[model samples]
Target: MEESTADLIRAQLRRLRSAAGLNQEEFGKLVHYSASMVSAVETGTRPYDRPLLARADEVLASGGLLVSLLRIAEREGQPSWFLPWLDAERLARQLRVFQPTLIPALLQTEGYARAVIRCDDLLSDEEVERRVAARLDRQAILAQPDPPQLIAVVDEAVLHRRDERFRALMVHQVEHLIACAERPNVSIHVIPLSVGLHIGLSGPFSLARGADGGWVAIMENQLTASPTDGEADLATLSARWETVRNEALSRQQSVELLKEVVKSWP
Candidate 1:
């Protein structure tokens, strides 16, 4: 198999770091990242973004070689609108998500992700596969040594998806959710159907608090998604998040609910 542009970049980074006589720990300090993050990038477990690449280029005196490679890799996948949100997500210290109609992208199983992407119908099979791969790649953040706190509030209806054709897939997805919820950095809460209608019905959105303490948010619609750091937007979404979270079942209750819902999938 041919190596992807991303793979090539990772290999080059690893080679360059070694030539600089810097171990992952020593190099990461210069780049302002954790050693584990440097290892993740070199090992192809995490996607390299522009900032990280640029910093590495300067730190290693690569004369912009790393950043140049990243430009090529960025063109290979991911939509333009999603790029900002993706960067924010990677740098976030805390992520708060509200999903009314489906599982949050970060927590979706591969099968569920493919199904959701395929719903577009307009996309070719190649595009669908590319998107699924990108979505799965985004999940690597959860495994980082210093992962962001991910608090997700989902509508109970998302788990009770009634498509018979997807029954088994949904079961596996819910089981994946149960496993994710067990992680200390992850919290999954479900808003019961008993709540009837609520503010979360507006749409799905996410807020990410970066390491610098600044917050940014992404609002998703059927056609596209956009990210914002404006005060007004943040304020409104923050209020909605608080309201939806309040309506959600406790974490323990949500996990129990997930277990029960899995049994109902058949």
Candidate 2:
């Protein structure tokens, strides 16, 4: 939520409390928040988080209005350009990904996803939560009755990068990767650091195969994804996919590599 949205919620809280003939201290008692914390939220010094908002909604007799507002605010926080790609991902019969920078979105744990999102120091906490929710929501496709076949070719560097803040989640993510690889429909590969140069070094890309057997390539730059369905472009990306496939470690080898990382993390 933006500061403006926070202000709106605070205003509503204040009005509802006033109407109920309760002072800040009385309202705080009802909502189980400190008087100072209530004041901070109302005066825009603090944002209204979900749990607080839920309690406030119940105390103020708002009939879930605040909770509904939270949902609306979260949806509004999503980046505009990313929605289309999400639609494609949900519909794809098969997904082929070449990721070099970080774990693929489908395999990330909530903690790992938030740690990655927080790297953008500019984003507010509410914004960070929204992005995390969006990313986790995207992971649901993997659990569908006939989920997409996930083939991820990731570089070894992704496993080597470690910091105390994210190391635990990285361990969790690596274990999760190994688990996903065990599924018959999923295939994961690691491009060994020894393979100094590879086609994936250029950047990350994904190929989504549709039910009709048509393939589309999605590539991202700094800002947003550009999905190409043109025959020539798809053909070129297909060849790149084959080249990376040959350079990456086999599925069994990738599982072994992930197990190694799991053992190495402190």
Candidate 3:
């Protein structure tokens, strides 16, 4: 489990209880939680499992419905591993994504995602379904009534390197990008290879604004993710995101560039 996310989930639960003016025992009784359970969860001494937390949300009436947490949790599958980062991402009011080697995950078309997922020869069909379902489910965050502001910066090379089938998929993907770019909550920028290596070379990262006004940074390698919630680390990621954003082409420019790429598709 990511320590950062674990702490954030616990903090949010504690805040909910405190706001309701309930002590641990009282809150426990309301949600059928044991006092020890409440204490353990709050202290991050126990796993902050989603199902348990969802029941508590019902008792507390947080309206985020706790089920949202569960959904986000299920997406990761390995709760003990990615829960913290997922929790922080779920609670964020804004998300900034920077992808240097691939299309932004949230914006991937079904076809594109299918091709990429198929490349994972180790994944059984069932495993691929599970992963793809999770990825698509995460896109729901963008459609919530109070969805986060999403700003994405993608590397241009992802747009140019594709086979015929992938090219067609990318054409659809770029159209989808154009539509998303029209939303007030979404902004997409493309990092042209011409500009060459920027701060994002550090790695793919997302900076999410937590409900508590703190920022959380998520870094992902091939199969694992790490989160940094320390103010200092968040500041560093935030600065890098800003630099990447500045170096990327504007949304209009990106759309134009994408149009030109699609035209050259064979």
Error of 2 at 155 (Å): 0.2
Candidate 3 on 1-266: residue-level lDDT in tens? 23444566677788889998999999988877788767856864344555567777887888874556555545545544466566566667888999988788888877778778889899899888877876786687788898889999998887877675566777888778888888889988999889886778778999887554557777888888877666788888888888999999988898788778768776
Better of 1 and 2 by TM-score: 1
**lDDT against true structure, model 3:** 0.76
Report the lDDT tens digits of candidate 2 across residue range 208-245: 87664656677888777776666998898899999999
Q: Which sections of candidate 2 miss by over 4 Å?
A: 1-78
What alpha-carbon RMSD in Å does predicted model 3 have with respect to the real structure?
8.1
Q: Give the Cα lDDT of each candidate.
A: 0.86, 0.80, 0.76
Instruction: Flag regions of model 1 displaced more than 4 Å.
Output: 1-74
Of 2 and 3, the candidate ranking higher by TM-score: 3
lDDT of 1: 0.86
Clash list (residue pairs), candidate 1: none
Pick by TM-score: 1 or 3, better one? 1
| Predicted model with the maximum TM-score | 1
Question: What's the TM-score of every candidate structure?
Answer: 0.75, 0.70, 0.73
